[model samples]
Target: MEAATLFPARAIRLRRDATIRAGQGGPVIALADASLQLPGLPSRICALLESLACRDVPEADVQQDLAADGMPGLLRWQALVTKLDSAGLIERSVLTPQGPVARLRQAAVGRGPGSAVRAPAQVKLSRFTAIRAAGGKLVAERPGGHAHVELETAVTGVLAALAGWTSAGDGVAGLSPQLSRAVIDLFAGAGLLAPGSPDDDTEYTDAALAQWSQADLWLHATSRGTRLTSGYGGSYPLAGRFPPLPAVRPALPGPRVELPRPDLEVTAKADPPLTEVLETRRSIRAHDPAAPITLGQLGELLYRSARIRRVFPCADGQEAADRPYPAGGAAHELEIYPLITRCEGAPPGLWHYAAADHALEHVADPGPATAALVMGARAASIMAADPQVVLIVTARFGRVMWKYNAIGYSLVLKHVGVLYQTIYLVAAAMGLAVCGLGGGDAADFAAASGLAYHAEGSVGELVIGTPASESASESGGNR
Candidate 1:
């Protein structure tokens, strides 16, 4: 298409009527030969007049049809039409049968049976060059966007999940994982997954879909602290506000290590039934094997508290990531690593929760003291035995800093709060006792995880099992 010219005369010959062209007379006149020159006429007006000469149709239908063409505001079309009328090139009349109509006569040449003569084509001229300046290329015609109904539905699901609906135990995404996945895939395919640059060059990088999924984890984690008189807890407060503590051993045990392979299945169903165990759940600092928690029970708890709920395809349409929890701006920076000790359902070893697969991958067997060591100075007194398992919530600063600028730290703080709380509530609902440990030795935790000590990821600890009496009191009986 040619660049739009100002006031170009646009002529239209109605396919159903005779051809219309501009005549030489100052006023539009019927033409025998298509040659005309109007005196004292503005060059800009000629462009619009010519555009009107190209098509043949009722002036009312033609004008109304042109008005419906783009995303432009109505005020703009009204102003342009008024300019043409004032220039005397076009006139409007209310015909008894046709209602209101706009037409051109004289200098315009077209033959039709109707007594009323209309502009052959509607000529639209932009009065201000600024109005023609477009933000970007006009979007391509989207054919079969009808099938994109699925995509629309998926986008809706993602938006709903982001809005806290999924975290509320709504089960919309959980029950329809495929739908959620489809939504992300559609967005990626549609080029809607661009990771726009962040304000802070040093902090947040970009808002990619992977980061979005990670943000989901943070959101779901923090959703547990739903009821609050003040914004003291919940995902919002923790966004980059609290730095992660290093992993350290409790006085009673050696420095924390990745534990040994547990006897439980990573995804197995534990005995005493998850439902029953949840009912009997309590914070017991000590565990009695006589209570022998089965493999399936362990898997159920892990899935409920930390499993990946959905994966979103990136803008490139080639990569994908998981969002086990909802995130704000999709800035995910936390990694959940488990320190398993006595769970019958899982091997007594270190494992990473793969949100993508909703499965656990073994990291190491740090031995029996692993739990005690992770709790560090925060552990129960020496008389108290280690709990069944400890979950280490690690933060990867780079993950967040990429999308959010330096202010991305705010997002990280929110991340920690959300993930930790989700662990708390889901555990509580399952009848498992959980505690959000304060400070830990951050340096030691990184060394154990075999990942760098960079700000991209850090440790947030949650010890689960029968909560000990003293530990329960330390929580101010909040359980």
Candidate 2:
């Protein structure tokens, strides 16, 4: 065992509540905010722990102090130290060029141990920003609002160096030993720094799975359930003021072709019942490329599934629109882009469906890559031939993020799911084939559409066409 020292973990505090009745047990001394709990200990034991928590103590000094106080046997002290180490209350120090870097035993923000400590390696800073709190104290908050640690703003330069803003020669070279250790300890506790070699692979390569980053997952988890803060739940006047409804994005500039859709009141009589459609909804992959989907069928599908039904006015002079499907904050952030391969009366191209105008805005001619993507979708669905149309559901993330703070991206994904079901049901009722894709390359979509990946990117893809005669016959009773 290498010589080690122990220091109190971030945010940990001892709470000694009112004493229990004589027969019940000893007074409960709770160790709060650590990775694990230490409770129901005697007063003497609590006092010993409290003393240890005050400052960093070397292992030899700790044992000497314990012996001087007539604390207990060495085995008992060792057991307590083990428990503290397991709970991430102990940070091991490793010597580095800057000074000693404190490494946490467990995480403060993300899934793994906060940060590894490798000698002679530059600390990798996470996406944590420093904010000034009351009394002129600086607090660094981890990404996704998970954890925070307070430190002196004077150490900002050190943090910047960790983030690779400063030259390696100057990086941590002038930082005092005490300040460097404190900054490293504080950053580790907040999960703002990680240990990584210069040659380490830091990029998350699994783009599909990495879409929902650790920060995203953390915000999604913490912002749900009870309405604890203004930024969460159905609480009105979020962050002190009710957010004005976002202006609907103007239809993209292109050749616009209006769609013909029957009024719902009139179509209600001719359309299949809702219950019947629900029961018959099946993801049909086998489509009859021979029988291409008509333009009228595509128009009806869009109008029935996504068109804006009504706009409700607010007292603040802003308006909220309701679509055929439910949306968080009544923000219809999703835009439909059709990748046409073989639709009747529609040329092979990329077109944007404008729900508000009930029109298709021709964006661009589908390049070979875009056509290949469509073919890939067809192959994934196990289809013998390509579908007439592939609907790429892209979301304008800003529309949702404008109002909701933490869980905005999560709500966008939920809206995508809701729209998928709506498309499925409408397709079933119309006797058309539809298959929702599991995942897609956002970069590919961006390349094809000339849209920024972050602003407007594909979330869901649904291939639609007329079903094969044999397949339709097999699904006859349900249909």
Candidate 3:
């Protein structure tokens, strides 16, 4: 047989305790890190194996030691080594530098150094969890899968060491080469070991990092289906209780005016086809200052696009109701507040669109800054005049938050996109002009709307008006 050398892989620990009783077969020893319970070994054999834990020993010397200790000698030694190798706990070879260093050299020269140099085997425990079970058995669990392996309670120390409770040097100090190899192999199979380092630098931009708060990022990460553990992907009752539905805030007690509900069937037949509308949709910035959009037109737009077509309680006892646009869990949490700058029939002011009753509830007079913002958008759009109405889309986060967890914000943004597209399509069909703003300052919106920044914040904005025929022609075709 060829000569062999042995060394302990990192983070393998062996423990002997009263719990490890000697049965009819042999004394049982637990390999904690590997979650293995090894039985069938005589007292002499156990003693012989323990002696090899502290340092490297030649194959011949190990065989001699086993024979001297009144054990089955080389045959037993070879069998144990094979078992450990399969278990991933020990290393047997003329070792050399590997891992990161090897990867670097390989990348630079297309090949790594030959197998002449010698080095100690290095191993680290991968992230995992071990839990005690009802029957005194231990269970080892790792991310990404539902499978778990059973282990002996006595070997818990080995798992703890692999979990980083102790340094690699300390954990593997006295572990037999075979035992160490078994632990490594078990963890590697289960993907419970550290991943290999990449040769390239991986970093994120400062702006990208700053865009999302740490808590926000954590919520997004945990809520995603890909990152979530099993039994966490589907919607579940929060704390085993459904929260009460927020009573539709009755049109902020102000000057309330009923809106005209235009006949939907008549409008659909009269308007251009869906395909034509979609193709013709454009962000028209220029408005006819002399002929602002009629108040009736504004009311019709809101009615067709955002008005609650119907409202019914959800079957699951969750405080959710279905609406025109698809919302996560049917939670129609978006609220519209129109800021009119130059409507023909409506006074220039901030008005909330009451969806339940389909009415405009005057909230407040538009501040100078709000008016300036509207005019600035018109100028940016190269419009002849300011838009007739600037719609501020705000989200009532609590409605969705009570039903969803980490994915709540992401869902809200998606709803905003849906609403934006709905508005674009509806405006195109109505032969009206519309522009969706890329972003708006939430703080500025809060100050103008007098709404709390946290509970209800602006998520999007859109400008709408009657496009000047001459200016529209000058702007050329759809863009």
Candidate 4:
């Protein structure tokens, strides 16, 4: 009998139409249409179909699991179920005992292509297992064990007396020739003694251990011996220093001092000749306020300095890599914000320039610092006082940290140096002035931008407009 017979007609009419939205703040497509619109989505839908085909799903249970999966925000599940029903991929009937039941057939199981491939698994070695495999092996030793004792107490006295003895026919010398050979064999077996150079004389002498340092003798004893009357030889004591000195310690570090922010003002001088501007570019710390730069000039600086040049697929297709400034690993983590106080043809306000779009996103209109900006940027105050523009270069540490982990901080700092210099050179080449700044209140600046302070911390700042004084060039030249 048909399952529909289990429920009254009224129950069938009570079903509600469900819809799903995909992507945020845009034209949301129907769940069924989305599969056709996106290249790989049909495969995902097929995987979901395969999962359902393996189970006996009741109509209500199907909806519950879909909701629980939390994919609706990205893929509207309820709406997709409705589309599946309309397409005859699934049929629902009233199972009197179970209320509403969904009976999925073979037709639904073969609906779409296969899903995205799974990632390969990684194998790792455990620390304990690795260490247990290595029974015992000394790594290395630190210095300074001997108390200035230059001779080996273990065998030094025996070797010393053997020296200063002369031999006669058939008469034994101070050190028995047999004893010297025995000590050499014993020490060599223990790894403390090694055969001397080929040119070394076989005859025993007082200076047999002359080359050995105090630390070396402590490890193994040296030998002194002479042939007796059966052979015939003599030995003597050499001058010696009783004790050796210890190694010196490294010196202490210098006191720390608060560093000044990067200088950001362009000096007041003829916009250095155009040819010179190209050849001898300088990071100007003063600017020409009388000749305020225009919005076009600002755009040029942003693009030549850091605009995204190209984007391509990274190792995994999950995320893309964008190339803006040259990064060691194409980790373009630095970002820019323009604090526009004065720019011709641009509003006198603050803006966040999206590198991807090369368009400005209006953030807030900080009327004017009417008062001095914190940190005594007198020039910035003069900019606020006389009105000028400041550009901030910030970094999202997480973007870099994702790949480099511990050393990402170093890479980020180096990136800042390259980017700031680019701006400095570009500003000079364009007949404009720029000062790389470092002293603005980061927290306040972050608050004004409405982004997480940590996500976009101010790494450096630049001021571009005009110089503060006319005699600045003469002062700079003298210095």
**Residue range 1-479, candidate 4, lDDT tens digits:** 23322231111111112222343432222332232121234444544544544433444544554565566522654565544434323332223343422111111122321111111121111111111111232111111110011112222332232232212111122223333222222222112222232244222222644554544442222111111011111110111312111111111133211212212244224345656765765444455566676776777677666666565655422133454356756667777767776677677656665565455556666644312332234454333343366777777655565554324556677788888777877677665556665556667666666567876677777776654454442222211
lDDT of 2 at 408: 72
Winning candidate number (lDDT): 2
Task: Kindly list the per-residue Cα lDDT of model 1 for residues 1-479, writing each as its tens digit.
Answer: 01111111222222122233455554342334442234434444444445545533233444565465443524443454444332222322222222211112212222212222221111111111011112331121011110111111212334334331122222233323333333333222222222222232211354432343434433433333222112423223333564322221112222232223323363244345556544544443444435544455556566665554554544422122345466555545567776776776566767776554545666666753444355572353222556567777776664544444424556666777888766765566545656666556667665666666775355566677644344443433332
RMSD per model, one decimal: 22.6, 9.8, 13.1, 34.2
* Minimal lDDT window, size 10, model 1: 124-133
Which is the better candidate, 1 or 2, if ranked by TM-score? Answer: 2
lDDT digits (tens) for residues 1-479 of candidate 2: 01211232222222122122223343222333323434455454555566544543444555665675464555666676555543334444333333333322232211333332222335556533444464565555554433444444444456656665222333263565444554565565555653344465243333543465655555655566222223554333343454443546577887878888867787778879999988877788777757799888999999999987777775544456789999987878898998999888788888999888888998889787687768767766666677778899998876666566656777888999999999999888889888888877788788888899987888888889888765452342221
Q: lDDT of each prediction vs. the true structure? A: 0.42, 0.63, 0.59, 0.42
Could you tell me the lDDT of residue 22 within candidate 4?
A: 45
What TM-score would you give candidate 3 relative to the actual structure?
0.57
The Cα RMSD of model 2 versus the native structure comes to: 9.8
Query: What's the lDDT of the predicted structure labeled candidate 1?
Result: 0.42
Clashes of 3: 14
lDDT of 3 by residue, 384-404 (tens): 556778888989877776666
TM-score of 1: 0.38
